[model samples]
Target: MAKPQVRYVCQSCGSIQSKWMGQCPDCQGWNTLEQEASQAATPFANKHNLRGGGRRIELASLSSEIEPAPRRPTGMTEFDRVLGGGLVPGCAVLIGGDPGIGKSTILLQAAARIADNGGSVVYISGEEAVDQVRLRADRLGVAQSPVQLGAGTAVRDILTTLESQPAPTLLVIDSIQTLYSDQLEAAPGTVSQVRAASHELIRYAKTSGASLVLVGHVTKDGQIAGPRVLEHMVDTVLYFEGERSHAFRILRAVKNRFGGTDEIGVFEMQEKGLAEVTNPSALFLTDRDRPVAGSVVFAGVEGTRPVLVEMQALVVRVPSGATPRRAVVGWDSSRLSMVLAVLEARCGLAFSGHEVYLNVAGGLRIGEPAADMAVAAALVSALLDRPMPNDLVAYGEIALSGEIRPVSQSAARLKEAAKLGFTRAFVPPRGNSGREIATVEFPTLAALVDHLTDGL
Candidate 1:
């Protein structure tokens, strides 16, 4: 038998190397390469025939009829919303978040709710003790819930115990990084171990018709720590995001095989547990008794839900020979720079000798391009020190040629704004905005600037 060959794998990018190096060649991450053992191929195995001996898979026709997957709703409405209605049997979910971001708390609450509803639930914690989980349950007022709890890090032992009994309706593995497989010599949380453990857990969920939810820890870059393949193996990938200084947490679905992506569920972290926020628009919108400069209401859509958030900007005149600073929060900084450039070149507004600051109120990040017009309005408002109408909302896409482009779901955005007592909307031309609110159409970025400067 040939001895096992030693290899170094980059934890950041999962690239394998012949030997260790100071920095990973693929990802340029310093000190991220770890030594791993790989079995060498034998001469007989290498020379094996390539003739197929396996069974072929059956192909299905595109016209074939299929029933929708059955869903089991956890009592938590926000959690169920993120899961595309509810949890589907045999569905594998991967939820990743930062440290102390309430990933475990939300899962535990869901587990308790399922158990209380007469569904079987098994929560296996790899990082915490059973007593600690019990203490948390008590704190959350769920101590009486009959949730089967266990603490283990060995994947084989956990599977063996799970297989001995009937399959549970919900199976939760808290922190997949801590689980290790005895078949691999690599340490837990390494690339090999996480991949192997996750594969085993996902396979078990598939065969046993149980829903699997895996909690994952994130890296400093806010990405799930482990091999990237782990995300592809799961049915749905959820990200729990929120700032530490804020009480609001946003659960967003980045990828979902069963439902639409970009769906978000809002939750508020409380002393007891995570509470669902039904009116998320209220949480993201600030109370404004009077019109304020640099503050604009943005009618945005998150997944299928229309959200109204406050866009705040600040522009300060800088002295000569000093570099102008551009600061942004909860919005893309590059996009901010692009919008500034367009305002300068296309709209004839100068921001060269000014420091610009942009923030999306309530710590909610806005990604859609529909926010471009709202951001531009805020910047121009701040620079000119002109307060916009308190009940006005803005949303549209800005083009490089200064033309204001129409966005999708304009009616939906308008309806949401109208529901929030907004009477006027600043939108692109030729868009169908509902009659509930009055809309002022802008043909170009210059038109918007004119409306803000002269019309307002």
Candidate 2:
């Protein structure tokens, strides 16, 4: 037998090295390499394995007809929405989030719902005891659900037990990081163990035709902890995101082989658990009985759904010789800087002596460039102490050349705004003109600035 070889693996990038290093060569992450062992290579192993013993796979034509995969609804609309409909047989989903961000809670709720609907469901927790899980189930009002529960961390034992029983319709592992394979010497949560355990679980899901949901731990930077390949091994990858100070949470699908990516499901954390928000726009919008300076309603789109959110800005003139600070919440600071630069250069606005602050209300983060117009509007309103119309919403991307560009789904945005009693929209040239709401076209940022200053 060949002796075991010692190797160092970078935990951040999953790159293997012969010796320990302070920084990873591939990812440049400092102090991320950890020691692991692998079987030493033998001379016969390399010489004997040349394409003779493997069975050939059958090929199929590209035009072959096939039926759509069947789906099992978990009785949660928001969850299903993020999933691109319902759970498909043998689908593997990986969800990651910060600590105390309700990843386990949502999975438990879904498992219970599936079990209650006459589907066999198994939930294995490596992070908590059976009693602790039961206590949570009781708190979430799902103690009576017929979901089978187990507590274990050894992947071999778990797989053995699962093989002995009939395949369940749904299988949920509380977290993949805690599971360790007996075949590897590395401890759990290491790169090797995570990769081995996930491979085994996903293989079982494929062979047994069970829908699998794996909970994943996230690093401080919000990337899922473990080898990056773990994400590619699964069919879907979801991130549960929200601020601890807020009740609303967003489950976003960043990668999905069976559905559209970038789709989001809105949920609210309550004493009972996570409840779906069917009308997310209502939850994100604030009271608009009166229009206030620095406040503007933004009609944005998340996936296929149209949403309206509030953008607020504050501009304060600092004393001469004092450096001005810029602060932003729930939006990119660099994008704000770009918008400010456009305002200063294209519209003759002076902001070098002012401190600027911008925020997206309701703790919801905006990533689309369509929010540039609304953010620019809010900043101008705050700078000039002018209030925007309460019944107006804005959506348009701004070019560095000061041109207002049209965004995708302009009609959807206008229709959503009209449904919410917004009577006017500030849109780009050739943008959607809805019958229910009047559209004001702004061909350039200078035109918008001029319109705002006209009433001043």
Candidate 2 positional error at 378, Å: 0.7
User: 187-242, model 2: which lDDT tens digit per residue?
Assistant: 99999999999999999999999999999999999999999999999999999999
Would you estimate the TM-scores of all the predictions?
Answer: 0.89, 0.89
Q: How accurate is candidate 2 locally (lDDT)?
A: 0.94
lDDT string for model 1 (349-400, tens) is 9999999999999989999999999999999999999999899999999988
Provide the global lDDT of candidate 1 against the true structure: 0.94
The residue pairs in collision within model 2 are none
For this target, which candidate reaches the highest TM-score against the unseen true structure?
1
Model 1 ranges with Cα > 4 A deviation? 1-51
Worst 10-residue lDDT window, candidate 1: 45-54
lDDT of each: 0.94, 0.94
